[model samples]
Each structure stands twice: as structure tokens, then as C-alpha cells.
Target: MIQKTLYLLLFFSSFSFSQFDDLDLTPADSLMQEGKIKDAIIEFETNYQKGNRDTNYLYNYACALAEDSQFDKSFAILRESLDLEIKLNPLFDPDFLNLRTDKRWNSFEDELISKIELEYKTIIVDKEYAKKLWKMRALDQAYYFQIHLAERKIGKNTTVVNTLWKVKNNINKENLEKLEKLIQQKGFPKKSLVGNNAVQAAFLIIQHADLQTQKKYVSTIEDLCKKKEADSQSFAYLYDRIEISEGRPQKYGTQVKYNKENQQYELYPLVDKEKVDFWRKEIGLSPINEYLSGYGIKI
Candidate 1:
């Protein structure tokens, strides 16, 4: 009887291990790495439905979807992954920037950011209470909030940009000073309140009152971006935006030019026929140019 019981337990354990081993994601990852995006998506979706919806599986699904150009679905899943565990290590994840332009992405990001801000507010309300509870919750929320904010800023999302600006506007001088001091000493800005407001409070430091105040936070953003392997287009877009903001002409593709005199950016064709065809296809302007003409560019 004892021998039979032991055998049964071993069989069950092995069965469990086999189940996980079968969905190890290595094969799907290889497909992704090899740029066989469609195959990877099918593999990942199959396993994800069969296995536990953990961060890794969700991330893989999101990545495969993005690679397959299913931007909306990919963004949704990535946000779901973040929601499961609010904190994530962006240094190791490359899916954030890939979904930047998806309309649904920003609303989800804002919701998460709001939650992070709330968590931060909780800390400020009572330091002792925060010290006890914040660490447990902070890891997920902080990491998520931090990475999301960084990505949005780099992606030049005007809504997020305005939100950060608003946060800075609301912070008082005394709290700002304290937060600055805390950041200098502890490497992260101190929150004056805990809860959803905490992220807003922290944003004050990043936005800063002046260029001198922004120096430290700017360095932090630079460091974070450097640590991650971001998409080339996203990186180039950020680089060009920074240059343009600093009164320099963006030196990228010949398709676009910044006109300092008019304070407007204009798109000029490198190859007139090819560019016209590309624009037409992009905006569905091929069959009817009039409908898209109101979109500010002529194909």
C-alpha cells in the first residue's frame, strides 16, 4: 500500500511538470526571435490559453501580437499584464513602446498611472503606515507607473505630457523641496501623500520648476531609456523631438522638415511618386483624396 501511494504521488508530480514543460515558451520565443511573427502568435496564443495567465505568458502573447501588427490587441494584453502585477522591469521588457500610437493604449495607461498615484498618496498620509504597507504594494505599482510614464514621455503623448505638467502645477514649494531632497538622498522622490495622488506628486519633481530643477530628473529619464532596448523608430522619434525642442533641426528621414520660420513641421516627399502612393495607402486616400485632405496633408 505504501509503495503504491508513493508511485501515485510521483506520477501526479511528473504529470504537472510535464504540463509546464510542454508550454515552456522556448519554442515560441525562438519563432519570435527568428521574425516568424505569425507562427509565434499562434504558438503563444495556444499555450497562453492552456497555461496560467502569468506575466511571462501574457508578455509573450503581447509581444507576438505586436510583432504581427495587431497593435490594439497587443496593447490591451500588455496593459492586462501590468494590471496583474502593477510593477514590471522595463529594462528586460521591450513591448511598451511598440503600442504607443494605439488609441486605446493611453486610456489604459492613464488608469494605471492613476492607481500608482493613489498608492503614492497613501505613503504621504502616514509615513509609519506607508513604511509598513507601501513596500509590499510599491514594487508592482511603482515599477509599472515608472516604466509607463517613461515610455509615454518618450513617445511624446501630449495627453500624458499635459498630465505631468498638471501634476507639477499642483505641488507646493515646500513639498517640492522635501521631495527633491529625498530624491537626492534616496534615489527616488518622496511622496507627500500616499494613494493615487502619490504619482502626481512625484511627477512634480520630474517636470521641475525650471531647467536647473529638471536636470536631475532628466538624467534619471536618460539613464532609464539607456538601460532598455527600445524600438529604433521610437528611439529616433524621441531623439528628434528632443533636438527640435532644443532649437535644432531634426536630422532624420528626408520625408519631414521642421520650418523654424512658420513654427510648423512639414512633410516633403523624398521620392514624390513613391511618397504620394505611400501616403495614399496610409490614409486610405487612394480612392478618395478629398476625405483625407482635411487631415492636413495632401497625397
Candidate 2:
């Protein structure tokens, strides 16, 4: 019974989508992004009343309320969120800065963290390993965004952008070394070992590694995906990467490249253009057109 309960918790916590992915929240999100906080709250409330009561919606609604200084309503919505998702670290969110001043904030934070700890302690076999992976994931992504920022603000070929790429490559190399050692010693941290996020983080490290490293782990990833131990989307990304590296048309169409001549992003060569959407759906990915749209590539 305990094993089943832990499995259930891991499944739900691992798969809860974010607000950005929830189409129903888009109107409120657009309003929030446009600095119309009160209007965003009203739109969010409208969605909630219409039965769009997912975890992401609730959390973002609470954030919108908190941003508008509606602390009591935000607190109530957040308390509702606790029952919907195993959200972590409510105490540190900038959106809840106003909530922090209220006397009830301390108890609310304690209750939130305590609930998460209770659930995580059951499923995460090695808390320290999970923490380490979280840090590694942060470092893995930190430089990429900075490199993009540098490319946009500074010239793409300028010293600042070049230096950022060099730094990022060095960090990737260091992260890969650590990840290889961890995989060697611990044998690919599965969901049960370090929790879902850590497992995904470890996979991201592998994804950033050289083609050979990605190839080395491809079969293992396939096995994990088959067993529901790892995310299928991660497997799709790695598979597409390997195919592109091997000079073959990708099967899932997850690989994209920037067209220097056209100033647009385009999908990589696919094994079968006509059936790419079918292949993507087989692996839990969206249609190729929809997926590439996120990269500014229209069908």
C-alpha cells in the first residue's frame, strides 16, 4: 500500500504541466504579462469558475492575486493549491512578496514545506543526490540563457558572446564529467532513486554531452522510457539529437536549426515528412507543426 501510494505521488508530481502550457490560462497570462494585474485576476477567476481548475491555473491565479496585493484571496487560493499539487518553496517566490508581510505567512509557508517534505521523503531515496542534481541543472541552463542575452545585447560575434559560449562549453564539459561519474557509481539515477526532477536533470546533462555520450546512454534511456522510469519526451530529444549527429533524417522532428540566410528557425530533415506528426504522437510529443511553432518555425 505504501509503495503504491509513493508511486501515485511520484506520477502526479512528475507530470503536472506548467501554467505556460495551459491554453485556458492564456488570456489571464497575456493580461498579466501586459501589466493588467486586476484584469488578469478577473480573467483567471472566470476560468476557475468555468471549471479550469488545474494546478497550474490555481498557482498562477494565486500569483496574479498576490501581485495585485490581494493577499487574503491569494492565500486562500494557495491553500487550495496545496491539495492540487505538491508545490515546493512558496516562501521564496517574488510574486508572494506582499503575502510575506502578513502574520499568517510563516505558518502558511511551514505547512506548505512540511507537506512537500512528507511526500518527498517517502519517494526520494537520496535527498542529497536530488539536491545535487537540482544544482547541476541550474548550472547546466544558466550559461545558455546568458549566451543568448549576450548575443542579443552584444553582437553575436563580439567578444562578450564568444566568451559566454566558451564558458558554457567549459561548464558543460565539467558537468558531463561529474554526471558520468555519478552514472558509473550510481547507475543512472531513476525516478525512485532521486525523484522525477532529478532524473530529468540527469538526462538533460546527458543531452548536453557530446554525441558519443548521448549515444552511449540512448539504449538505457529507451529501457527507462519503456518502464515508465523516465520521460518519453526526453527520450525523443536525445533520439533526434543522435539522428542529426549521424547525418540521418530525424524520426521525431524534435531537432531544429537556425537558418542564417533566412533569419528563421527550420526543422531538421525528417525520415518521413508526411508521417512526422504520427511519429511525434507515438512518443507523446505534439504534432511537428505545433512543436516547431514554439521555435518560430511555421509548418
Candidate 3:
């Protein structure tokens, strides 16, 4: 009976470890949905420590940290998530769009972009291998390569732009022109699409056109942004324009904001009373309007 009980105990122990092996992101996700950010952070940290470092868990952890008003910690976690995603599957990683503007986020993105370019160059040079593997890997690589380029343009990462331009110079002029147009049409100047890199590529075809042409493309973007029709790129663009533009940028809290009184950017806490005191005491500025001086209200 003792031996049998020991065997059962060992089995259950192993089973429990296996169950938690991948850092089940569900609890953190649920807590986030319920606005239990501190609790979610604790759960996510537990999972992260268990080596379940998937992108979703990392993202959720970062989100939880942000919701708890820990901006620097959240950004750090986001950087980790971006790096892991790039390393695991550059072809399908959707974390890039989330971290474009973050200074720390850019370094990892640049590294991945560089690696993809190098890989692409090597593939192009190996004609014999390319011919053999073209059916299997060529389309996938091409698709990802195009996506990386599109992301660079949207993020206004000048190095990426120059690299993409060089790559474009090597491709057919018609294709390059198409890409340019798409960039203008999709407002690549404003945002990065996380998942649907292909749609961003399509948008690159007309991203920099005249006003009338841009207006024409807005409908196309609207179509892309529709829930039924939306992929990551479309949803990302829409999220930036609508949600992020409103206060979702602060959803994962940030310190930087334009101070209308001081006419300078200031880092203030999410807590209203502290933020009010920060403006008045730290900056020596009087509140012009009480209505505009709180959470979700950007100066």
C-alpha cells in the first residue's frame, strides 16, 4: 500500500508539473479581463518562473505590470516577449507591432530585421539550393521578408527603410513601385500591423500617394479593419487609430504626456491625485482645466 501510494504521488507530481510546463497564460488573461492586474502579475510571474515563457504569457505579464502602473517593468517584459517571438518564429511573430515605438523594443526588432535580411541574401545567392527548396521555403521566406520591410516603413525605422530600399533596388521596378504605393495607402507612417504582414505589404503598394488617392485607400483600410475581414495588420492599424488613440496606449501605462500648460512633455502617474500634485508641485503649474487633468485625459 505504501509503495502504491508513493507511485501514485510521483505520477500526480509529474502530471502537475507537465500541466504547468507551458506557463498556462489563461489565468493571467482571465485576471486581466477582470481588471485584477496585481493578481494577474503574480500569476504570470509564477508561470514565467516555471519556464513557460511563451509570447502570450510575456505579453500578458507586461500588460499586468502596466495596469499596475509599473511602466518600466512592463516595457522590459515586452522587450523580452518581442525577442522570444522573433527567435521562435520570425515568419509569424505578431509581437512586433506592439513594441515599435518603445526604444528598448527597437533593438530586438532591428536585430531580427538584420538576421532576416542576411538570410534572404544568402537564399537569393544560392540558386541551386533555392531551386530545390523554392517550393517549400521560398514563399514563406519571401512573405516574411516583405513583412519585415513593411514593418520598418511603418515604424519609421530609417535603417529598415534604407535596407528595404536596397532590397527593392534588386527586385523588379514594377514590384518596388507597387510596394511603395501600398505603404502610402496603409498609413505605414503611423503604425505597424502585428500579424497580417501581408496586408501591410499590400498597403505598401500605395502608402505615399496624393490626398485623393489616400482617401480612396481609406475605404480599403476600413474594409480591412472590419472584424470579419480583419487580420492582425488591419486590426493593429484600427487599434492604433481608435483604441490606442483614445487611451489604450495608457492601458499599458506610460509616463510621457504633452503638458498644455508647460508646453512640454511630462511623465505623470496614472493615479489622479498624485498626477495632479505632480503637475502643480513638481512642475509649478496651475491646472487650467480640472476636467482635462485626469486618467485617460491627455494634455
Candidate 4:
């Protein structure tokens, strides 16, 4: 179970991204998640037309095309995604299973891997630490893919869900301990020191940590953001996480609560609903609506 999760979820975390500053495609993402392939394609194309060229968005668009058995179209989009420097590995992604049967798949896969390797070669510092951070990220998200399955197969309050959370909590605690020690030794990994992917992993470890840990490192993250060493979206999410944890309304609507009764997601309280986008724009984040749409969430 753990190995499967790692393989399947690894692509989602393998690359740290800067392209997320573009418009959000949550509506399309939600449609794809529900297997509404045609709707998702339409939504994705609309977002693409509107200038949402983020590699993650393109990857999902390609997946929707593949799910619809539009291999040629999907491959074209995958090529476009590669041009955008997508870090996802299609070999392990179940969404591209159908594409594997195509004669063009092997060559495309080789090209994709080669390009990914070429990009990785650009990481001049902390290569080993970056690899370690990627593994940490893999562990951080490894069990999340099973939570919904557990909830559906049994129930949210069942031992299955409890065990998943317990395991994830343990992983988070362990990652946090390692991260703090790294910070003490290396003074927080930045892009120049450890490359963007590793820095992103470090940020994610802190983001997944407990409230006290977040509070302790929030200023450090903010400092990194100010120096342009970290992505503002990271700080935005962490800021909202800290706010929501402290019982204060979030400023950027980056935090959401899953309403299991409705089987939907809803944003946490916002500090100012009207000016939220302004605040988000100030920090290089997408508007709250665009951000919420990715989660199928509404204001």
C-alpha cells in the first residue's frame, strides 16, 4: 500500500514549481477528479485560452484527453507540458495507462525523461540534499491518496482513516524534526543552497508540521519570500494555515475545510472577502475565486 502510494503520488511532488503563479484551474481539476473527461477538457481548454499555462494544469488537461482516449491530442498537450518544464513522470501516472499502448509513447517517454534530467542537471548545489528533500516530500504526501478511499470504503471515523492519519502524523513529526535540525545546521535551505525543489520540500515539511512548528518557522518562510528565495504561494498557504490554526480568519483563502456531510470543500473564513484578491495579488497568488475553483470550492 505504501509503495503504491509513493509511486502514484510521487510525480505530483517530484518537482517544485514556480508556474503556479498563473491562474488556477480548480474547476477543471475537480471535473477531472470526478472523471468528467469531456467537461474537464472543455474547462481546461477554456483556462488555457485564458492564459493558464501552468505545467500542472497542462498535465491534468493531458490526463483528461488521455482518459477520453484522445491519444494524439493528449500527446500534443504533453509535448506542450514538457516545453513548459513539467516535472511529472508519466510512466508511473495511472492516468496515462492508455497512452502506454501507443507506438509513440516510448519515444515520448524517453524525451520527457531526458528533458527532466537535463533540468535536474541545472541544480548545481545540494544535489544530494535535494534528493533527500524529494523523498521527504514523497513521504509527506504518500498516504493522502488513500484517505478518500478509506473514507469511501469504510468511513471517515473508522480505524482505516484513523490509521492513515496516525501514520501521516508520525511522518510529519519525523520530517519536522529533520527539517529543524537541517535549519539549525544550514539555516533554511534556499534555492541557491539546495535548489528550488529541495527548498520547496523543506517548505512543505514546515507547512505540514504542527501549529507551533508553523508559528516558529512562519517568519523564516516570510523572510525567504521577501528575499525571493521562496515562492510567495508557499508563504500564502502557510500564512493561511497559521491563521486558520490560530482561530483567526485567513487573508488569502488558502485554507479550506472539507465538509464531509456535503461531500464538498469550503474555504476557511477570510479576513476581508472583498479585498482578499487584492491581498493575494500583493503576494503573487491567484485570486481567491480562481484558487477555490481548483478545489471545487465556492465562496
Highest TM-score, which number? Answer: 2
Give me the displacement of residue 30 in model 4, in angstroms: 16
lDDT of 1 by residue, 222-259 (tens): 44335431122222323334444456654332124447
Measured with C-alpha atoms, the lDDT of residue 116 in candidate 4 is 63
- Give the range where candidate 1 is weakest over 10 consecutive residues by summed lDDT: 9-18
Regions of model 1 farther than 4 Å from truth = 1-25, 88-93, 119-299
For model 4, how does the per-residue alpha-carbon lDDT over 1-299 read when each residue is reduced to its tens digit? 11112232121122121121123437776554444669979998998899988776787788778878999999988788768764645544546656777899767755654566577775336655654565566556544645655665688899778988887788778988887877787688887765666677777777766678879888987998899887777788788878887899988877766688999877778899999999989988777788678668767
The residue ranges of model 4 lying beyond 4 angstroms of the native Cα positions read: 1-121, 260-264, 294-299
TM-score of model 3 vs. true structure: 0.31
* Candidate 2 stretches greater than 4 Å from native: 1-114, 117-122, 296-299
Against the true structure, candidate 3 has what lDDT?
0.41
Candidate 2 lDDT over residue span 7-66, tens digit each:
111111111111222334377776664457788889989889998877767887887787
Q: Which ten residues in a row have the lowest lDDT in candidate 4?
A: 11-20
Against the reference, the lDDT scores of all candidates come to: 0.43, 0.69, 0.41, 0.68
Instruction: Work out the TM-score per prediction.
Output: 0.33, 0.63, 0.31, 0.61
RMSD of each: 20.6, 9.1, 20.7, 9.7
Error of 4 at 4 (Å): 15
Q: Per-residue alpha-carbon lDDT of model 3 for 1-299, expressed as tens digits?
A: 01001111111010100011123337666554444667878888898889987775676576556546676777788668766554313222222223333565445544655564465442223322222222212122222334333554465366665676555444323443544454455433221232233343343333222334445555656555553333333332232233323354421122334678967644433335435534343323335234234333544
